[model samples]
Target: MYLGLDLGTSGLKAVLIDDDQQLLGEAMSALTVQRPHSGWSEQNPADWLVAAEEVMAALGVAHDLGAVQGIGLSGQMHGATLLDAAGDVLRPCMLWNDTRSHAEAAAMDADPKWRAISGNIVFPGFTAPKVEWVREHEPEIWSRIDKVLLPKDYLRYWLTGEAVSEMSDAAGTSWLDTGERDWSDALLAASGLSHEAMPRLVEGSHVSGHLRDDLAKRWGLKKGVIIAGGAGDNAAAAVGMGVVTPGQAFLSLGTSGVLFAASGAYQPDAPSAVHTFCHALPDTWHQMGVILACTDALNWYAQLVHSDAVTLTQGLGPLQAPSETLFLPYLGGERTPYNDAAARGAFLGLGHATNSSAGARAVLEGVSYAFADCHDALSSTGTQIGSLVAVGGGSKSAYWLELLATVLDMPIHVPEAGDFGGAFGAARLAQMAVTGGGASLATPPRTERTIAPRTDLQAAFAEGHARYKRSYHALKEAL
Candidate 1:
């Protein structure tokens, strides 16, 4: 057996997988996301460790630790976890969703040398800007920062007594050379940071260290159990869904939505529309387009109307076509195709008869349209994506899946596994590390369901997609 751990924003998720890739047990422990002010997001480092330890104990109750071989760590990407000389957390981790360093990001992007070396534009959500944010706003805290770690690496340090990061996570920091796959001294100097302040880099599946005896006892694992270096959450999810091969893609709808595809060589889009990152697969690369507020809009609507899923979705029939009402779907600003962080979501062409069900359906359609835009961007840059596999919280919604099919005018398939994305990828990596073999990661065994494009909806989405493209243009001045 092997264990996989995901240190997510709101919780620590762990899964136990046997040698055959079958799941034995799973556990989760929830944490908090502190928002002291607007546009700020933070989480306690110790909270993740506590949650991981609890989940491990709960999972151990069902599966014996004696069979466990290796462990893998995965977590939210681009979150900067600052640490001091004694390995104590200097402050709450600055998360990826937080947009507090726009000035720093813009300044970094202004330099032609950055794009020449890193092959990507700077973003406030990335690590280097967060470093700069701390350096300027919180000088006292910045002075105490002896080292910086991403979210997953912070948890792995507690488990294995080592502070190391995998390339996939490091690639999101805006300080690594995407082509050469290491820290770029020029970029680091530009950001006013030192190379020694960053953690050591390793491949995603490389074994970083063994479980310390005290932590092993606390988590009911054998002393010296190997821990593999894990990738960022999305990369790990792509691997778990078997989207690690070129031309294959995965769609995730959680707090955000993303369309991701693996690549053999580094491919960065001009103007930095899509983000290029190292894949969880060794020596492979991938690109992603993120929808800032995918299901999050739905969540907000649920709160506003005071209705549950059962109540809201009761009378909704299959959408015959895209509605005339179009949604911008940018409650939290956009990344790909439009790099504006201040962009806000909107609903255009709403009429008097638009009900709660119509609002829900439009939200789904808007996200799909955004994905179609992403597809266009990829095509312009020469990525050959054939199929898209849906995962995360939205994969269970048949209605949303059907909408994606109509919007993309292609079939959408779901993996047999439900929502254990990054955790499952971590387990698979652990299995590979334990066996020391180059086994191919299994594709999502078979399609749970396939949704084909609805002919009637084609024209409506085409018009709506055109207007969707224009919505960003109209909102640009306001942003």
Candidate 2:
């Protein structure tokens, strides 16, 4: 048996899989994000360790803990977990969604050397910008910083007593020369950090350390259980969904929306605000276009009107092709195609006739349009993605999946595994680390069904997509 742990923004998830790749059991522990300031997002690293330990205990109750051979980790990316010299957390981790570092990111982007060295722009959500923000705004905390760890690595440290990071997660930090798959001194210096402050880098599948005896005993597992250098949540999900080969991709509609495309070599589109990063596997790379919000946009709107997102959107069934109501799903600003952190969501073309159902439908269509824009940015890298395997919370909604399919004009497939997104992928990575190869597990993902594009909605959606693109610029100018 092997275990995959996902330290997500909202929770911690654990999945247990046997040597044959069958999932034995899975569990999750909820976490809360702290928003002391308007645009700042923070989480307690201690809370992550507690949640991780708790979930592993729960999962061990059903699975043969004695048989657990290895562990792999996946997590929300770009979070900066500052630690002191004695390895104590200095402050709450600045998460990937935090937009507090917009000024820092813009200042870094102004330097031509950054894009050339990192193969990507340093966005507000990335670790390097967050570091600069801390240096500038919280100098006291900066002075105590001895190490910079991404969220998953912090959890990994508790499990294995080693501070190490994998390539895929490190790629998002802006301190890495993504094309070279290693830390860039020039980039680190730009962020006012150094190589000594970063964790040692390893390939995602490589063994970074062994489970400490105390931790193993507490979890009812044997000592010497290897801990593999794991991946960022999206990269692990790609591995889980078998989107590894070039031209393969997946669209994730979780808290944020991600359009991920696999690339055989380094292919970057930093100028377009597309993320170019190392893949979970060695000698591989990926290009990602991100939307700061996806289903979360629906959740936000639903809450505004005192309804749940699923009931509000899914209840409307299949919305008509391009209703006049168009929304910009930038409630938390956008990443791909536009790196604007100040962008806000807006409902354009709404009139007296606009009701709750129309509002819900508009939200879904707006997100799909955002995905379409992201697709254009990713495709510009010359990777022709024929179809996308859909995952994340939105995959459960047939209406939303259809909307996405029609908007992308490509088939969207939902796997049989249901909502187990990053956790399942982490487990697959664990299996690979223990047994050399685990490709059989994800080759097909037990696809539940495929949603093909609605040719009938083609023209209407094309017009809506055009308007969706225009809405952002219009709103930006207005704001």
Candidate 3:
């Protein structure tokens, strides 16, 4: 048996897979994010430990933990989890959706060399800017910091007593030279960090350390279980969905929206807000575009209307007509193509006659247009994205997926593995790690169904998107 763990912003998930590449057991424990100020998202690292322990114990009830030979991890990327010499968390993790570091991001982005080396315009969500923000705003904490680690690496330290991170998660720090697949000294210095602040780097399939003897005995497992270097959530999800090949891509509509595609070499359009990062694998890279909000917009609207997404979108008709209302899903500020951390969401053309259904569909359609914008920008990054796989809570909505397909004018593949998210990918990586990178030992995920675009609706969505673009810029200017 092998174990894969994912420490997500929403929860901790543990998956136990058999040697046959089948999921034998799985469990999850929910978590909460703290918002002390607007546009700021934080989570206590202690909560992650508690939740992870819950999930692992739950999984143990269903499977024999003693048989586990290896473990892998996956997590939300770019969170700043500062630590001291004794390996204690110094502050609540500043999450990827947090935009409090906008000024620092702007400072780094002003340098062309920073952009050229990192292959991304520094966004407040990336790890590097958060470090700069903390250094300037909380000098006391900064002075005490002995190491800075991403969220998953913090957990890895807890499980294995190892301070390490892999390439894919490290790339989000804006401290990595994407082409070289290594940390950039100049970028780290610009971000107020040195090489010493970072943990050692490894490929996702490489054995980074062994599980602690105490942890092994407590969990009914043997000591020396190999821990494989893991991946950022998006990359791990892609691995789960089998989006390893160049033409393969996927749209993740979680707390943030991500459009990701793998590449054989580094391909970047940093100046245009496309994210270029190393793939979890040793010899690959990926291009991605992120929008700060996606289904979270729907969730927001649901709360306002005192309804849920399923009820709000339940009987809404046809993809072509969402509503006269146009929503800009910049609730957490924008990313792809704009990188406007100060941008705010809006509802345009709302009429007294408009009902909740129309409003719900409008929120979804507007997000679809945002995704369309990301798709175009990613294509400009020189990757010819083929069919896109749809994952995340938002992808569960059939109505929303249809709108996305029409607006993007591309089919969206729904695979059985979508529900597993990154946890399954970590398990797959663990399997590969134990087997010495043997590709033939892994099983490809099965497709649930495909949602194809209606060419008729594409023209209508194009018209809607033009109006959305205009309203979006006008709103930004007004702000």
Q: Provide the overall lDDT of each model, using Cα atoms, as 2-decimal numbers.
A: 0.81, 0.87, 0.86
Model 3 bad stretches (over 4 Å): 317-320, 417-420, 440-444
**What would the per-residue lDDT of candidate 2 be over residues 212-293, giving only the tens digit for each residue?**
9998888899989988888999999998887888888899989899999888899787888889899998899988999988
User: Which candidate ranks first by lDDT, i.e. highest?
Assistant: 2
Residue 83, model 3, lDDT:
96
Candidates in order: C-alpha RMSD to true structure? 1.7, 1.4, 1.4
Of candidates 3 and 1, the better by lDDT: 3
Off by over 4 Å in 2: 418-420, 437-442
Compute the lDDT of residue 366 as modeled in candidate 1. Answer: 82
- Candidate 3 root-mean-square deviation in Å: 1.4
Q: What is the per-residue lDDT of model 3 for residues 53-132, given as tens digits with 9 covering 90 to 100? A: 89878977877799998999999999999998888889999999999999999988898988889888989889888988
* Model 1 residue 299 lDDT score: 73
Candidate 1, which segments miss by more than 4 Å at Cα? Answer: 270-272, 309-315, 417-420
